[model samples]
Target: MTTADVRTVLTDGDLTVVGQIVHASNATLVCDAQVGDTVVRCVYKPVRGERPLWDFPEGTLAGREVASYLISEALGWDVVPLTVLRDGPYGPGMVQRWIDTVDPAESAAERLDLVDLCPAGSVAQGWLPVLRARDLDGDQVVLVHADDPRLQRMAVLDVVLNNADRKGGHVLEGLDGNVYGVDHGICLHQHDKLRTVLWGWSGEPVDPVLLADLDKLLRRFDGGFAEELHEHITGAEVRALQRRIGALLEHPVMPHPRGDRRIPWPAF
Candidate 1:
């Protein structure tokens, strides 16, 4: 289906819970939402199912997820999938289009190499080593990935949104060759809470394309983005988002991990 059709189905569809994601910390369900004649598979997170966070308030993760989508859309980056906050079988929560992921073993095998096996410059052509560690056998190994442009864009998105839970699993590569970010529940806070697993571009120059997108976002907020955002998040959080954009605009480079705990645990 076309993207517009998907958006319509996601925004104004008959949501039906098909199953539950048992591993999720919150109440997450798999749903088949009907829009006109089409049914779109969606991941639904209900507020009533939310587990309270120490830093963030209770039952507010759902709104944060939707707010992340709005900010992503405003930046003109398809970082997050089509998402919305609506009443469902359990209660009000965030519902997003589910992306079918490319097998990680397949995707990683093509881009990664064993540090001990590959020649010095053999893997450096377009691949960047991201992880160096010991495998289960206690052998030194390194993991590399293609310098994918989409992953770079997603890194920028995470920075702008102040995403706090950008786990490796959150970065999904679809069969259609598009990379999407999901599960942005504790984001856009008024503090410097940008924890993520996408620091491969750390210390590199920010591409002009990404800078331009940030500029566009600034203009949009100056126009009406802040006003619209207030519906989903607090006024303070909206200001925090603007502050993040301004910081990125001034830096114009990929940020390095600050302090000792900038990145998330279990980087994979």
Candidate 2:
């Protein structure tokens, strides 16, 4: 199908469930949806299926997912896939364009290289040391490619969304060789809850290109982007989203993890 067809399907498609994403914590369904004459694979996350979170209110995850996509598009990052909130087989939910990823493990491995141990300088030649551990048997450390511009944008996106659960598996490398983020159900809260695995750019200078994109988002927020989000999140959440954009524009630096719980459990 053409790009326009895919958009039409995701926008006003008749969904037919192909299977359930059994491993998903919440109810997630794999469906083949028809737009007019074209069918495209899509993922559905119904609001009723969301498990309650003490930090986030109920029935808001699906909206947050849609909000994240809007923010990504506003920033011109294109990190999140095309997503929309609409009625589904179960009820109102979020439907996203399906991204066919390469093996998750293989993609992860391609970005990381095993080293003997943490090296001096912490910052290597365009690479940054991610983690280091020592067992009785041996010592090991993993370094990630910090220079990858795509990942840098994703990190910025996580900060803007205040993403609370950016596990490794959520960072999918599509067959087209582009990275897309998924599972934004626990994102964009009014409070500070940015948990992510893309902290490789910590303490580094934010790229100029990213800063330019952020400026665009600020303009959008001032115009209608925040208003657009009212259909999904509360007024306070929308305000918080604006505040995050302002702060990032001012600082324009990879933030150091300050929260007590910086990384989400079960990182993968």
Each prediction's total of clashing residue pairs, residues at least 3 apart in sequence or on different chains, is 0, 0
Per-candidate TM vs. native? 0.88, 0.87
User: What lDDT does the true structure give each of the candidates?
Assistant: 0.81, 0.81
Global Cα lDDT for candidate 1: 0.81
The alpha-carbon lDDT assigned to residue 212 of candidate 1 equals 91
Runs of candidate 2 with Cα error greater than 4 angstroms are 1-3, 103-127, 133-146
Please provide the root mean square deviation of candidate 1 (C-alpha atoms, Å). 3.3
Cα lDDT of model 2 by residue, 1-268, tens digit = 6666777898788999999989888999998889667888999999999999898999999999999998898777889998988899999999999999666476555344211224334555666565554444664445344556777788889998999998777877688878888999999899999987777788888888888888887888767777899988899998998898889889988899885677776666
